[model samples]
Target: MSKIQHFAFLLVEEFSHLAFSCAVEPLRIANLVSGRTLYDWSFGSENGATATCSNGSVTLVHYGFDAIPKCQQLFALSGIHMRNHVSKPLLAALRRERARGTRIGALCSGAWVLAEAGFLKGMQAAIHWEYHDSFMEGFPEVNLVRSVFVADEKHMTASGGTATADLMLHLIERDHGYDLAVAVADQMVYNAVRNATAEQKVSLQSRNGMRNRHLARAIQMMHDHVSDPISPALIAEDIGISTRQLERLFGKYLNTSPKKYSMEMRLERARNLLIQTESSVTDVALSCGFDSPGHFSRVYKAAFNVTPMLQRGRID
Candidate 1:
């Protein structure tokens, strides 16, 4: 049998409950399925106060940063306005653990904190898709990938949700065996388990409920050019499809026009920036490809029923 592994999850305020639950539960089931104490886990907070998640749920920690114990590994779990929660103290604690030879990793947007501490310089990391734009803009030294997770690349990083479960399963498989990992997954009823290299979101074929490669490529292009968005016609041409065919593809599966999808994508990015950064509404508008604040305001208000100004300070 492999040695028992101890893990610590350091929770930042506004962390994702889904990510946290998915992370801890997989380990629990690994023990249950294996019928051995294969893993142990604990939670910590930056302050003694309970860490509140993005969904407004609270989790009591075993201790604060001052009390984090030596473990086989540690993962920082955070989401939403993660920029607000990262502190020098937390970074120092993580660095101390790394120096002691603990494997450090991140769940969800926690990569932002690691990058802030210079732990991710020149390392390929993954954050939740929502944070990709701001993270790249802020930390140019970190190589950010769109994968759901990256395992054991100096430091592991998972984009969160079920991706956390996948990472834990990968560890279980490596340390224990593939059969044990499959047993743990069976207990969780989590079929279709993904590997670390899988992309963050559901595959477009399954998610869009279709198998149109052209449509998928077109939408991916839209996501890639949030700020400097290309027209739907350009995307279609790039994908080797006529504009009309692309429009039909979008209409059939997404129930929206390509232009509308692109607009919503840009608006969603705008919202993320406004919440996660101190950028002014004008800057957010420009960064999201709006020609002017006035145009962005009108579009934003139409879609979300509130002006960009009102949404600027809102988190999550």
Candidate 2:
């Protein structure tokens, strides 16, 4: 039998409980299915013997940042407000682990911590899609993809949630054999496992529960041009359909007009920027294709029932 591989996870404050379970359970299942000690795992935190997740569940850890032990691989796991939790001690511990030649990875917003430590610069990485806008604005040096996971880089990353399970299954296959990985996945009743190339977001077509190619193309166009929204006529023309037909498609499938749908898309992006990034309101307005901050504020209030400034203030 191959020698056992050891893994350690440094759980950040308010980490995702779902991602935590997904990351560790596959390893446990792999050992059970193979009837061998294929892998072992431990947890560490910045302080104390327990770390709390975003859902208020507390987990016991084997070490703190001050006492991280040697392990074959170390992954940083985090969730919302991850930026606030990237402490000096955490960076120092990661740097020390790197100096010791340990393999490193991240899950969810944990990429923010590694990027802040200057390890993800000039490397291709993945983070949860909710953080895409803020992460790009913060770490332009890092080539961030929308993939569910990235395992080819020196530092691996999973885009949080069940994507961590996909990454774990991939690693199991890589370290042992494909048969064992399949068995582990079967044991978990996870049949729809995605590869690393799979994107983090479900397609608009899937989410809308429709199969109209033209509508899908139009929705994709709106998403791609959130910062410079085009008219519905232009989108219809680009998608090789008449404006009337485009309206009909939207009315039939989404029960909304094309123009209104596009506006909602831009507004949603604006809300994400308002909460996730430190960009000014005017900047956020302009970035989401609004010509004036006053108009943006009025429209935002209509849609979300709060002004941009007040929304941001509430979060702060």
Candidate 3:
């Protein structure tokens, strides 16, 4: 019989409880269905005791970084504000474990930690979209993908949330077999097992309201033309509506003025470019449709409470 694959989860503060649960429950259910311990897992924290999750819940840890036991795989689990949590000791321990040949993976924003430890250089990684901008800025040498999960060579990374479940299911299939993995998914009532190519966030249509096709088209246009935004009047003309009618539609459905919404969209794109690309501030500003770098700086600072230089520096 094959030996059970030992797994250790390194949990950080504000870790996503949903992601952690999704990652572990599949293994537990797989073992139950297989009638043997195909997988063994434990949790570890920085302090060897307990760590609080983002949702105000706490999970007990079986060990600390210093006491991490031998394991076939180690997955770091973290969430919001991940950049602020990495310490010298944690980075050293992760590097040491990697040197020792323990296959390491990350869940959600845990990729941020891995990247900070300099483990993801030149490797494909996935992180939550909310942190995509900052992560890109911080890990310029790493290859970032928009997929829900990335499993390349030896490293595994997930964009977190339900993606964790899908990754765990993939692991189960690799270990037990496809049939068993399907059974586990059925037991959990997971209708669809998302593959790595799946997107992390919901589609714009589903997120914005199902019936508003005009709003959907408007949003799509905004996304497409972030670099050269169309005027609200032009957008209204293209969508075949009067400017007043468009304003009414936005007011009723989106609760924001069309101009404000367009600015926000441009600013969001600028933020992504500021962090993801090595483009100069002037280039980024012009790319995002801001006529002047000074104007872009003012708007960016107003939106994110930091200058573009400082934001980029933080990632560095």
Structural RMSD, model 2? 16.9
Score residue 176 of candidate 2 by CA lDDT: 88
Candidates' C-alpha lDDT = 0.83, 0.86, 0.81
Query: Higher-TM-score candidate among 1 and 2?
Result: 2
Q: How big is the RMSD of model 3?
A: 15.5
Best by lDDT: 2
Which regions of candidate 1 deviate over 4 angstroms?
202-217, 220-316
Q: Which stretches of candidate 2 lie over 4 Å from their true place?
A: 202-217, 220-316
Task: Put down candidate 3 lDDT per residue, 177-288, tens digits, no spaces.
Answer: 7788888998888855665654455577554342587777887888788888898788888989888988887665444577987787677666667666799999989988
Q: For model 1, how does the per-residue alpha-carbon lDDT over 77-161 read when each residue is reduced to its tens digit?
A: 9999898889877888888888888889999999998998789999999888767657777987887876678895989999988
lDDT of 3: 0.81
How many angstroms is residue 285 displaced in model 2 relative to the true structure, after the best TM-score fit?
Answer: 41
Order the numbered candidates by lDDT, best leading. Answer: 2, 1, 3
Residue 84 miss distance in model 3 (angstroms): 1.8
**Cα-based lDDT at residue 159, candidate 2:** 92
